[model samples]
Target chain A: MRHQTALNPREGDVLPPFEKTLTPVDLMAYGAATWDWYACHYNDAAARDLGLSAPFVDGQMWGAWFARQLRAYCGPQAFVGGMKLRYHAMCFAGDHVECRAVITSVSPLADGTEIEVSQQIEKAGTRVASCISVVILPATGVAETDSEHSAGKATEEGIRT
Target chain B: MSDLLSDEIRALIGAERYYPAHEEIGGAAIRYFAIAVGDTDPIYVDDAAARRQGYSGRIAPPTFVVETGQYAGNTPSANGYIPHEWPWPKGFRTIRGGQDYVFKRPIVPSDRISVRYRLESVEAKSSRDGRGQLLAVSLAEYLDAAGAIVATNRELFFLQPLEAGQ
Candidate 1:
């Protein structure tokens, strides 16, 4: 098992950003599974009629993407406690979307570290999904579990690892 | 109120599963999701860096499968997919109520996987303020290439029916 990341002050927190393109297949697959079958997602003509150049990706799908990004920094011991996202604009299929996140606040808690992170999903420089993630990190001074172990122990137990 | 059994809605939920996509799981799909949501952690992008940090390599963000039905299952729809029945009134917006995970193993790209989804269950309620509904849970199970279970996904949707322009 790994130890939780020690709380770092944002004064020196640095983040890496990257760009990715969503294939029409990816968009349709997500929509089909999530049951969020708004026509604008799989129907390009409908989307264009709605003012988009092509089929749009669902914002919830974008939100799910944001959660995964935040967890990368928080690590295996990271627990997403809360998440909220606002769809600022349309992200059409096959468009290049950029993702980025930065640590906003890190506070030590009784059992673990509380982290607040801000994330954004953009398309061709337009913001698609912008959101905040609240997570609980594994605490310091805890015994390491070399095998399978839940990352964050329930508050009832004294969490040292 | 409990209109789930209504013939119209069930027809939508019972559509044949769409093509379940094959994904590396930790690939760009995850990165895009992260970026769209605004996370910039190194683990999402750098394989060497994540290995240095003790992970085997790049991995799908925790919610990687939220949108992919390979893990959530898909059904063929004669009338098209009906989605979990939603019955909210006015200013109706929905969101993730919360999520809990029991990771049997951390997902790694080398692991071949797929998901099967079931509508699971639904709940509905009504009041004078208008009408409302909740998708208490939509359950999904992840399977390795050999057909071993890897993870489970349960999503909740809170629906508000009345508000304009949802």
Candidate 2:
């Protein structure tokens, strides 16, 4: 759960790329729990009936997966501002999903560090999920070390104003 | 062309329901989601560390929204699992295509989060394999306690059948 650094991406600063091989349990879990019981995510008969190659994974699952991928690089306090992903290919259960990211650009912003992240999730070299993440890092002057981010981003407000 | 189906789908957007998840719920979701990702951030846990960071208390991980909001509009399920409950012929596979999320502001505790859902549009397109398939896409807006738009979600799902044996 402890996070890694995502602020500076040097030429070879590639955090370990991740590959997750999903099982039917993964798909079924999505269906049963997260209100995502789409047969393509679980039932093979449903997949073939619907004209898919195999039972695919849940998009919401990937939502979390994408966040996890970024978390791996950005450390804990990475504030995701805007996220957009296009699903290019189908990710079937039992397929090893490879998720990765490259820090496309890092710039200092008024509020904090602006880290624009380019992300990809591939299954055997085929892109499954491709995304761009705009994350707000701790303020440069304030966040001297990753430990400050360990708690969470500083907030100006709580539940009750 | 007729927008009848589009209109009908648009009508399918139901009344908004605000699932009031408090700090505990926020913390639980952050824990679960982090567990799924194998993250061990103090923000996710270690309240003392959180206090040290001047957060007052621990803050849930960012993607905690998925945990708090992903299953927002679930229909009842026979099993223990949460079902998508989309009105379609039974036994069709559903695959989430993608999402476009715009976070107007960071999520915080005590916020009465409400997701306003609308059927953006649905269209039948020819799959890469040359088969005509239905793509149902919807949009949901996450509103804060004061009702300001916190985030906008545009999601697409490919409805198909499950594949052959595992």
Candidate 3:
């Protein structure tokens, strides 16, 4: 096991930004991996039939991106307890999108620290989607298998909303 | 209620269905999902690294449950895929609006899971784009082989009118 120090998150701290340019192949691979063969996501003709210029990225894919960002920032010991996302605009293949996150709140638990993060994906200067996520970072020497500190307990406590 | 929300559609609120269990989660499936999402987290692909982290084995990505049905005996509809069995109102196109997820536990390889979906609510609203639309909210509870709820997903779908040229 690689040793990782606990993430000391502070409210209002902004995380480093990352960017990706969506492409037809990337969209197709995502669809295949997720088993989402929605025609509008893979067929330009089908998208045009629905009044779109081209196939668009799946809204759920953003959730995966958000989780990935959280995992990258919080390290292997941190567990994403919950996430809420809202899609505000469409992003098409070939559009460059930037992802950003800011720590909103950090609450201390007996076995871990719960951090709330606000994240958004932007295409150009316009926002494409936004997300709120709850991540639990276990204290040093605490193992994730500890029943009391499980992600389920975090949701049941209504801390994710 | 908007003219687009029919009586039959309203009745769908609270409807529930259970999908069959998915095949045991595998290391390959987890790795494929992580790669597709462009995640480089070794814990999702390297069991030894995961064991060092104190997990029983390599764990699936948090959002991987969304694709579990792909491995089920009966392929279920993809997320946001409205079945034709529903008396869907015509002249409207359905699009995904958003989603929420609450993961209760780490999903490990060999865990067989199932989902129970319930229609939570349907509301009529004016979209920001100045179109009348129906916002449907549904909940999916993911269960493990022992019937414990492992996670839950809330999905939002918007049904809007087809604009000019559509």
Candidate 4:
């Protein structure tokens, strides 16, 4: 789907934050979706046996949240080329996690603009994970007027994730 | 550089094991995953919306490749997904350290992906509490029917020895 206004992101731009409260149900569904049925992610008893107070969110699930944040900030035509995620701490179910990103660099490509985004997932003020993502935004029509385009930042409220 | 890695484990480095093709990516699976991740993107759920975005059919979320093996009943052992044929050390707890992924192409419905796993490296490191930990780096390549890699995932796992007593 074509975005009404093309995104013209600049370096140092911080994307709008995406937040979600993960529950045991969310963890189970994420495990089912990713096929990462590790007991610590779903079974509370198993998690306690492993020294955790409760089942924790799968580290890989943060990657999906990062992708969702980028898709929300760059529009649907953008492609997520790569991502590097480093897990710092365990986030248990019921924690409210906020995903945030900042554009580190923006380079012009022949057909699109390549942007490196530094992303992080924070829970209760502590960083649970950090990520570096590369996204390629397709070269499309320029904004008809400067006021018409907010570099994709104006639609943050419309983003569901 | 540490003696934590046995010769058997060290020998696994650079060895690649290929698995059979996974079940075709279907619209239902894509939609299910999208919903699980709380993504309401229409391109992942509606074929018509995807076609409008230049995709032939509904596309999957970028990380969906991680689950393709599960559909084929390839449950992961303690060694991680795409297990090695050799026996892994028992009584060690496996912890995910990090993950890196490079997507070369978008995965769409009906795409049957074949996968291969390679042990990239293993090392001994000290955990935050000074316990000796064995770090294993594994690589999984998801290939299309044409044998071209569509995505590559590198997983970092830390195997920590279990302490005595429950």
What TM value does model 3 have? 0.87
Tell me which of candidates 1 and 3 scores higher on DockQ: 3
Best by DockQ: 4
- lDDT (10s digit) by residue, model 1, range B1-166: 5642344444444232322436555466556554544445555666875565567786655565444433333353332444433332334444444333334454665665676655555456563465645445555566777777666655555443433333
Off-target runs (Cα >4 Å) in candidate 1 are A1-12, A33-39, A46-52, A141-161, B1-61, B64-79, B85-166
* Order of the predicted models by TM-score, top scorer first: 4, 3, 2, 1
Give the TM-score of each candidate.
0.49, 0.73, 0.87, 0.89
Scoring model 1 with DockQ, what do you get? 0.13
Q: By TM-score, is 1 or 2 better?
A: 2
lDDT tens digits, residues A26-137, model 3?
7877877876667788788888888889999988889988888787667667888999999999999989998888999999999989999999999999999999999998
What fraction of the genuine interface contacts, i.e. the true contacts, does candidate 3 reproduce? Answer: 0.50
Question: What does candidate 4's lDDT look like per residue over B129-155, in tens digits?
Answer: 776888989898888888899999999
Q: Please report, in order, the local distance difference test score of every candidate based on alpha carbons.
A: 0.55, 0.59, 0.77, 0.77
What TM-scores result for chain A when each predicted structure is judged separately against the true chain A? 0.75, 0.76, 0.84, 0.86
Task: Write down the TM-score of model 1's second chain.
Answer: 0.61
Highest lDDT among the candidates is held by which one?
A: 3
Can you give the lDDT of residue B69 in candidate 2?
37
Candidate 2, position B94, lDDT: 52
Pick by TM-score: 2 or 4, better one = 4
Off by over 4 Å in 2: A1-6, A9-15, A24-55, A141-161, B1-26, B67-73, B77-94, B108-110, B158-166
> What lDDT tens digits, residue by residue, belong to model 3 across residues B1-166?
2876878788888888787674787788788888888877678888886786777778988888864445334433443333222335667787888889999989988888887888889899887787689999888888999999999888898988887667
